[model samples]
Target: MSSIAFMTQAQEYMFTYSKLFSHLKQNVKQGHEDVKVGLFFLNADTKKNCVIQKAWMEKEQHYEELKTTRYNELLLPLDDNLKSANPLVFVRTPQDQRCDFSMVVMTKQPLKGTVSYTEVEMLLPQMQVMLEDLGGMFASWFTPDVEGVTLEFQGLVDGQVEFSNGKTKPIVNGKAQVALSDIGQGGSMILPQETSRVLPYLPRAD
Candidate 1:
């Protein structure tokens, strides 16, 4: 095959691989959230699980007490009694799907404060209930056709959610949008050059 033909074939294979893995990651994160809430309702140690997850995500100084403290302050209680509370939404772009991305917006009021372990422990049930209710209610809105990128806007206003597909005008839904540059800013993941590792999962045409 000509060099151009080879390059095109390799690029196609990589796209396929990216789609496959992206879908897998989305499924896993969504499924895991469901399982965590279910377990929490069943009196499982869901808070500890959250801590462990935070540690993994940070992947640096997992033993740092300050990080743990902040994590707890930012997420706990799950009630409206918080002094200062804000929406904590998690959005992730899928590998291969019709929709641009998937997101989980936790309860309208996510707890925020420094509390004793026992206090947080006492509030676990409320937190779990809120999470379950919020997740179940918003499940439909996050399905595969919601194409657009969400961004967080904290300007003169309290906070704003900016939505855009990078073509038409941005849509403001009065909520903070999750800015996923890799998806919203298209062509962010393009490979600079062809390589032998492009078709690892399939037979090579070359």
Candidate 2:
């Protein structure tokens, strides 16, 4: 699947998971007054697992050219023979063990009662990129004009990248309000106006 298509799929999964999270908060009522949803991309700026990190970095850089808005290649881990394996998403518990969070994106069913065999998987290349740049996976989706959508991806290619350590570099971060009408815009929904108002010194990607 192309990058655009992958974004759409990921959004759908996010929506599904979000709804499921909401349901869990409501249903498992310890009369639980506090309720929240949405899973964050945890530790997004740093590596979490060494094995996964090595596999991802070793993959050929997606593209050769170095551009500010694009990303390089991504790699996924697999069995010894280079076969694909399902990527696992989990939260770290205080016990130092991986706790299985009930995620709806991976499974179509409720994660409470039965064994959830659903494995949410995506091509590693789809994720290995500077997510907040012009040509990155997040760029187009974040547009203000974009509303509810199910994007169809065309193709995939290796791409360019800009140089700098991730920590100091500033991405075009801005605030956005995702009303019900703006459901399909993925994580970013910052408008040009809001971005301009908040980030006066931001550089133009184009």
Measured by lDDT, the strongest candidate is 1
Q: Cα lDDT for residue 143, model 2?
A: 31
TM-score for candidate 2, please give it: 0.16
Worst 10 residues of 2 by lDDT: 115-124
- Residues 115-193 of candidate 1: C-alpha lDDT, one tens digit per residue: 1223223333333343344445664344232222222221212332222333222323222222233224322211112
- Residue pairs in steric clash, candidate 1? 22-95, 150-177, 150-178, 151-177, 161-175, 161-176
lDDT of 1: 0.23
Off by over 4 Å in 1: 1-74, 77-144, 156-206
**lDDT of each structure?**
0.23, 0.20
Once fitted onto the true fold, the runs of candidate 2 whose alpha carbons sit more than 4 angstroms away are 1-41, 44-81, 84-173, 182-190, 193-206
Model 2: per-residue Cα lDDT over 1-206, one tens digit each: 11111132222111222222323333233322221121212122321211111111122333121111011111122232222222222222222222222211111111111111111011111111111222345655653331111111112112111112211111222222222122221222222121111111112223
Clashes of each: 6, 4
